[model samples]
Structure formats: structure tokens, C-alpha cells
Target chain A: MSVVSAEALRERPVEAVPEDAHDDGLAPRAKFLPSLGAVYRAQLSRARVARIPLLFVATFQSIGIMILMRGVVDQGGREAQAVVAGSAVLVVAFVALNLLAQYFGQLRAAGGLDHYATLPVPPASVVLGAAGAYASFTVPGTVVTAVVGCAMFDLPLTHLWVLAAVIPLAGAALSGLGAALGLLAPRPELATLLGQLGMSAALLLGVLPADRMPEFVQYARDLLPSTYGVEAFARTFGDHPDWATVLLDLGVCAGVGVASLAVATWAYRRAAVR
Target chain B: MCAVRGLSKTYPAARGRRGAPGTPAVRATDDVRLDIRRGEIFGLLGPNGAGKSTLVRQLTGLMRPDSGSVEILGHDIVRYPERAARILAYLGQESTALDELTVSLAAETTGRLRGLSLKDARAERDDVLEELGLTALAARPLKKLSGGQRRLACFAAALVGRRPLLVLDEPTTGMDPVARRAVWAAVDRRRAERGATVLLVTHNVIEAETVLDRVAVLDQGRVIACDSPAGLKERVAGEVRVELVWREKAPMELSEVARLRERAVESGRRWSLRLAPDEARSAVAAVTGGPAFDFLDDFTLATPSLEDVYLALGGSRSGVKGLVKA
Candidate 1:
């Protein structure tokens, strides 16, 4: 119960060394997936307190948007399907792209890259683990939005299960983008600004119908990673779903996810070395 | 064990035109060489901007040196910095990455990252928390703890899964005397029982003199002195410090007062003088035992300390007097 003094420890006889000593044949390097799992669990626990409340906010924001859009589209046409799907995927963009960018930007600006760099964990694990954790937060919000949107748009509920594929794919792509934006930006404020801009792009380009937009606008929509995710989900609302087109859109999302995550990992290394 | 050879790191000057000469580059570290033996507690002492942090960063492999190599247990850490995490446990000067995690989770997570098994990590977390007297605050978030308590939590995390070397930068900065004592006790125990080498960088010379087995003093990016505290203090052992506090305004016309004013430092009514032991003896006896005694409020003579050695080595700060000159 009492605090032990340095003099007290000095007076005691030296005890035998324990076996699991820090120097006993240097600690083996922690493998990738295991350490990634550890980082993921840590991020999950760390975000558990603040993020759950924001998750509700993100869900409500998407649900609120759908209610506003319901006034103009009287018929359950392609516009309604686009509006519903885009609103659903917007939830993914809010957390995975917007919040994650803010998290990483703050992390990097605060010299947090050095924190993880000092650890034996791989750079890829940090990037992938954090992206995965943020993406994981999108699941409930995305599912809720999609179910609510499908019912409101008078779309078939049978194919909503495709979200099992959509959330992870879109989540990965947007999470990677968010992580990169935050890590690459020189300042935390810039990172937050970039994240908001990306979410705005997701809202405008993704939530709106592509066929109604001008040629140049449609081109810009193709460049937006979340647009593919929205399109994939929207295709499922038709009388007969086009699995081929949906898979192509999903393939592009997965490709962008891979590329964005690689860039985030590269940015992590660049920031750490300084 | 850690070996640093020909280590030199110079930060480039930030401004210059293409053809014109640039601003002078700040030499953060210059031609430094060191061999830290296992089981010894080595201190790195210097004034502010004395390149202590730059040296520590290079040693920990967070920053690559401009030239030279750092080897820890035969691994060239400069080339393979990823291995550094396994070889060294670092308690940084300002760590906020784990502020969101609770004290216990911080320790447990650090243990896991350091490759401890889940059960072992928990067990070590418990042991370290108990040893640091942090068991009571283990559930508290780091941000919610006082500065000293949060620092203790970070230290506990560093100790969770040990590496061969401990690179602690001001580990006891905000700690109370008792907590500081505990920190040193834990470090000293680890070195004694497990032969861990410690590279402690601090401005607390008083504590360093007591806890350090050997110390290196850096000035302007150069290692001006490297020796045991007693060995370094031996350089000034022949000297004594004479401190006096006058009751009122200094009698400048008095020969003794004039003599004291010439070389001594003045702070209000107090004056401190450092001199050869024989000279100090004569000055103290004359000032305190003679007519000058009437003007004196207090006076004392003391032997030189490690702090005096630091001051004598051209470090960019004046000596810090032990008393408040009251």
C-alpha cells in the first residue's frame, strides 16, 4: 500500500532474472494479421465512446434527406430508386469518408504517425486496420438507411441482401480515401475540409440520377468512388436485377479501395520518416 | 546493447536562393559515438536546444541520421528501423496517442502490440499497475488523470512488454517526489534484475546525479563530456560554492563586498560565489567571521555537485541554486 522508495529497492538483494525478460532473445516480430486484429480491436474500443452517438446522427441525416426528397418524386420511378440508393450509401460516406478523414487528420497533425511507427506493427496493418474499423461503423447505419429507403421508394426488399457485398466494398473504398486525405494533408483543418468536400461530392454525384446529368457531370460522377456503390445498390431495385452490371460496378469499387489503401499506407510511411 | 558510430545529423537550413549561399544549417548532432552496455543506467543531459531530443530521435530510429550507423544487438537499426520496436521500449516526452484509451487498456494494448500473449499482457498490465501504484486509477481515462498520473500510465505502458533497452525522455517530468522515486525504483530494479540498459534523457540533473551510473553532456550538438557523475564532478571537486544573503542593501564600498560583487552572481540581497576550495575557505571565513558579518543575513559553504559540472561544461544556462535565496 505504501510507495516504495528507490533506496528500498536498492537495499534488497538482486533477484533472479525472469524468463520472459525483455532482452531474452529479442521479442519476435508480431505477425501482420494478428497485430492488425489488435489494432482493429483497439480502434474499436477507442471509438466506441464517441462514435456511437455520431453514428445515430449519420443515420438520421440520411433518413432525413430521404424524407425531404420524397416530396418531389410522386411516382416510384428510376429517380426514386436513385434517390433511395444514393441516400443509403450516403450514410457509408458520412462515417467512413468524413469522420475517418477527421480522425486520421487529427492523428497525423498531432504526431500520431510517429506513435504507431515506433511500434513493430506494419504500416499496412495500421492503414488497413483503421480503415476497416471506420468502415465497420458504417454497417448498421448503411443497413438501416437502405431498408428505410427501399420501403419508401416502393422497391423490392428481396435484393437488399446485396448490401452484404455493397457495404464492405464501398466502405473500403471511402475509408481508404478518408485515411489518405487526412494523412496527406499538412494540417488537421485541411484534412477535415477535404473530408467534408468528399462527402459533399458523394451526396451530389451519388444521390442524383446519372442519366439526367450533363455529359461532363456524368464523367465527374464516374470518378467519384461512392457513385459506383450507389449505382450497384440502385440496380438491385429493378424488376430483374442485372448481376453483371452490379458486379462490374463492385469490381471498380474494390479496385479503387485497393489503390486508395495502398496510397494511405505510402502516406503513412512518408509521414513517419520525418 | 546499443552502439552508435560516427553519428552525425544536421538539419538543413530552411531558406536560400538557388545560387546564393543558404542560411547556416543547424547541426543537431555532430560526430557522436557511444556504446551503452547492458544493465547500466546512462543519462543524457543538456540545456534546452542542446540537441538532446535530436539525438534521442535518431537513436530510437524514428529519424535517420545524415551519416553514421546505429546498431542494436547486431541489427543495423538505421537500415531496419522496423526492428527498433522490438529492441527498445520508448516513453516519449509528450505522448497523446493513447489519451482516448483508459489506463488499463493503454497498458494492455501496448503489451499486445509488443507481442505479449493476451493472458500475459493482462498479467503484466496488472503487475505494472500495482508496481506503479496506478491500480486505483487503472480504470480512469488518461486525459482525465492529472499530468503526473497520465505520465505514470504511459510509463506503465512502456514497461508492459519489455524490450532490451528503455529510451525514456523525461519520464518523471510532472511526477511528485514520491512518484519520481517510484519511477527510478522501477527502472533501477529492472536494470539490476534483468540487465536492461536505460538511455535516460532529462534536465533533472539532481536526480540524474543520483540514479545515473554514467552520463553524457552535450553542448551545441557536441559531446563535451561523458563520464560517471562522480567522475564528471571530479573536474570541479577542488572548488567550493559560497552563498551569502545580506540583510540589506549591498555595502559596495566595503572591500569584501566589492570583491564578492566582482565574480559572484547577485539576486536581490543574496550573492553566490564559486571558487577554489582554499579561496572559498578564506573568503567564507573573512566575510562571515569578520566585520562583514554585521551585514550578513545568512551564509553557507558547500562542495561542488553534478550541476556545477554541467554549468562548468559551457552549457547554455546559469547554475540553479538549491535554496530560494531566502
Candidate 2:
């Protein structure tokens, strides 16, 4: 063999050698098998380490709000349940709003897309990995929100498994949407504006009771995923278990998650190739 | 081994530009073709806006060519990028280091991603850190390092993969002469010990000449010349000239010595002669033959170098006009 070809053969791993050869016995496996889980874990670890301050603030805020709500519930005033439920919905929205905004903002500002594009992993893997990091970062807030919501408002712990599933699903859905928004936004300033608009829309649909709103407003609220989240959380606090409502909410959140994830995947691929 | 054939790239024109009543595409690469042999240090020399980085990006599978094919180690970059990526290591002109991560962690992570075991990764990291003189700042975050140090760290990350092919885009930029030499030494070692192929994109001709086995010069997205450094220098027409100066005035002028030798053999007094285009041997013989030649104080011989060829071929104003005409 010529020198160039010989050098090329020497660089190949033993597994890539032909079967007829009496060379080192090794078998070739599938090539370019991307380890999505490994990439996800790395991204999660990086984000977790970088967002320490945000985590601290979320923890303290959750505790303080829980304490304040407990005191309000002790007063036993008329319409206290209504006020407590409204406050719970507002708190959930606040936590979700801040977490999503911060996560997306950081992703854009850090040039995370550029970093992932040059990796050996596929573009889909990069998108999922970044989304997974945001998902992991929201876990602490999701847990704190559910735990505090139940304890402070004297809410029942029935159907705990379903509630446990709901929190992470909600967090993932919101985070996915946020990631898509971050990808689409031209700049940080635009992202902030769009984030505020999203938060405002969510608050209007989520914190206020549909029955209290006018007919047209209630009809509009049905289009939003946040309305389903509010219904699910409120039903958990009530005496009757609304299984159908819970299923519908989970289905809608899952659909939104899937759609946003698709957007993120497309955006990531475009960014990589460009 | 990497091969790029008939590659072309055009960037979209920006908005609000009036040209022929429509926006025109900026042709970044124009039907460029080259083959990088295994275990050889090939240099791509070009000035700014010469599309060297674009070509490098295409070979490394960072970008798809608008038209043409790029195969890395027998795998087509467009059709099988993942397979190509396993054996190819790319260090872009821009620093790709995560500012928050320590230098050691960046190298370790790069190794891990390339499928190195943790123990092996750590061992390799230490070896590379020591080799690049980065041991003292291994624990420091990338943000803390100077521009040159950060570039070195990025280079170390690229080397950590231990892939068979390395594509370096301006690798020695922001490096001191000692550090640059050290990098060249490491690159040479890789080619010698592991038979690694390296594609170096650089504009610094002097530094590149030390390591490149062959060079391709690109001008405005086209390959104008491709050959070994010595071969390229030989293409330029010139003769080696030697000038000899004595402490005192010589009895005969340099031209007189040449004409007198052609006419007849004559005894000579103390004389210093400057050899013409092709007369070094006879001139040296006649000078040494006389006793006065023993007092020769200093002599210097100058020949055409790569820099001179580069200037004649690319730097001259008329050369560019000629190329355009051709």
C-alpha cells in the first residue's frame, strides 16, 4: 500500500478492521450513535452549576409565600378560600413566569446554540439537551410550589401520584415554550417583551376564575393551556375529583410541549447548518 | 484524509442593496478543489476574505457546501457527518471555549465527548497541559486567561480528541514565538508518532513555512498556486549572487576579473570579486588561487527565498492584474 493509504488504515480502530484479517479481534458497531442521555446530563450539570443564585432565590421565595399564605388561611374570614385559591394560582404563575424567562434569557445570552452546533451530536440532540437542562432547573421550584400550595392552603394530599406527574409535565411544557420563544426572538430585548406578553396572558387566564369573567373572556380562556393548569390545580384543592378535567389538562400541556419541542428542533437545526 | 471537490458557497446579499435591480449573492468559495494527504501538515495560505475559514468549515462538517462534495476519511461530510466527525478534529478561528469552565475541565470534557475513558481522559489532560505549558493555569477558568492563553487552551482541547485528522484555522494566532514553536513541535510529534493529518489555515507565511509540507495559496476564493515551499521558490527566476568585500580596496574591479579570466590566465594581485549569475565556482577558484585572496575579511551569498517568490507571485500589483486577466 502507498504511504498515505497505509497511514489512513493505521488510524482506524481495531473494530473497523475486516473480518478476514487476523488483526486484533474486535467488531464494528453502529457508527455515529449519538448518546442523547449523555449530552442531556452534561447540559443539565452545566446549567445547574451556573444557576445557583436563581435556585436560592426560588427556594426562599417559595418558603416566604407559603408562610404568608398559612397566616392568611388562619384568619378564617368570609371568601377566604376564594382569596387563597386566587393567591395560589398567582404564585404558580409567578414561579413559572420567572423561571421560564430566566432560563430562556440565559440560553440566548450565553451563545449556547453556537456551542452545541459544533459538537458531534445531532441538532435534535442539542435541542433536547438544552431543553432538558431547563427542565432540570425548574424541578426545585415545581416541588416547592406543589408542597407549599398543599400545606399553606390546607389542601388535600389525595391523588398524590397524579399531582407529582402534573408538576414536572407543567414545568417541561412551559420550559419548552420558553425555549422556542428564545429561539425565535431576534434579541434579548425582544425576548423580554414577548416573555412579558406571555406572562400577562397566562396570568389573565390562570389567576382569575372563569366563572367571574364575562362570557366572551371565558370562551377565550379555553384556548390557553394555562387555563387547564389552573383548573387542574383548583380541582385538586376542591372536594370532588375532576378526573376528566385533569386528563384534558395533561393532554393539552403535552400537546403544547410537543409543538414547542418541534419548533426548538427546527430552530436548532437551522442554527447549526447556517 | 479529507477531499473537497468543486466546492462553492454564496452568501445572501443584505437587504436594501440596489444591484442590477435585484440582490446578488456574494460568492465566498468558487469551485475550489484540493486533497489533504494523511500524516502531512498542509498549509492553506491566503489573505483576509480568501475563504480559507469557509473551506475549513465545510471540510469539518460545520457547514454544508452549496454545491460539491467533501469527504473526510472516506465518509461524505454531507451524507454521513457523524461518521466523519469521529475521526476529524476542528479548531475554528474563533475560540470555542466555555468561559465559565476551567481550562482542565474543558480539555477533559472534550476528551470525554470523543469517547475516552475517564482515567484516560485525565491522564491525557495532564499530558497535554504540561506539553502546552498550561499546568500552572489548568484550574483557572477560561475568562481569567489572556487572549493568547485562551487560544492555547482551545488548541489543547482540539488535540485532546486524539483524532486522526486535525483541522486548525489560524491555530498560532495570539501566540508568542516560543509558544508557537512548541505547538509546531507537538503537531510534528503527532504526525510522526500517530500519523495524523493536519490542515492548517494561516496567513502568516513565515510561521507556516516551518511546518507545512505543501502549501496552497488562495486568492479571492480561488486556488492560484499549490506546491511545496521550495518548489514555489524555484519557480521564480533568479541566480544566487555572492558579494565578497575585503578590508582594503582591491586592485581590479569585479567585472575586470571576469573578462580577464575569459581572455587569458594571468597572475593576480589582491582582489575581491563579486560572482555574477552563474560564475561562483571559477570566481572562487581564481580568488583562492592568489595569495592576496587569503586576506578576505567578509563574504555573503544571497538567494531567492519563499518570501521573495510570494511577493513576486501574489504581492506585486501587476501579478494580481495578470491573474485577473488570466
Worst 10 residues of 2 chain B by lDDT: B317-326
Candidate 1 residue lDDT tens string, A1-274: 1134557667865655546654545677667887788788777777785689988988998888889888877447898889988998999999999998999899888766666777777889888988998888788988899888878878788888989999999999999999999999999999999999999999989887777789999999989999999999989988988999999999989999999999999988888877
- lDDT winner: 1
Q: What is the C-alpha lDDT of each candidate?
A: 0.84, 0.63
Candidate 1 clash pair list: none
lDDT of 2 by residue, A1-274 (tens): 0222445446743343223222221112112323355455555655555666766565555456556646544423222333333333333334444445544555555454434455565555555655656566656664556556566556665644564556555555665666666666767666666666765666566544455689888888777655655566556555766788878877887787777778867765665555
lDDT of 2 at B178: 71
Candidate 1 regions with alpha-carbon error over 4 angstroms: A1-24, B16-24, B243-262, B265-272, B281-300, B318-326
Write model 2 residue lDDT over B135-191, tens digit each, in one string. Answer: 999988776788888888888988875777888888888888777766787787677
Instruction: Report the Cα interface RMSD of each model, rounded to 1 decimal.
Output: 3.9, 7.7
lDDT of 1 at A241: 86
Candidate 2: where is the Cα deviation over 4 Å?
A: A1-34, A55-115, A144-163, A184-196, A208-230, A239-244, B17-24, B95-97, B116-127, B133-139, B176-182, B235-311, B315-326
Error of 2 at A29 (Å): 9.2
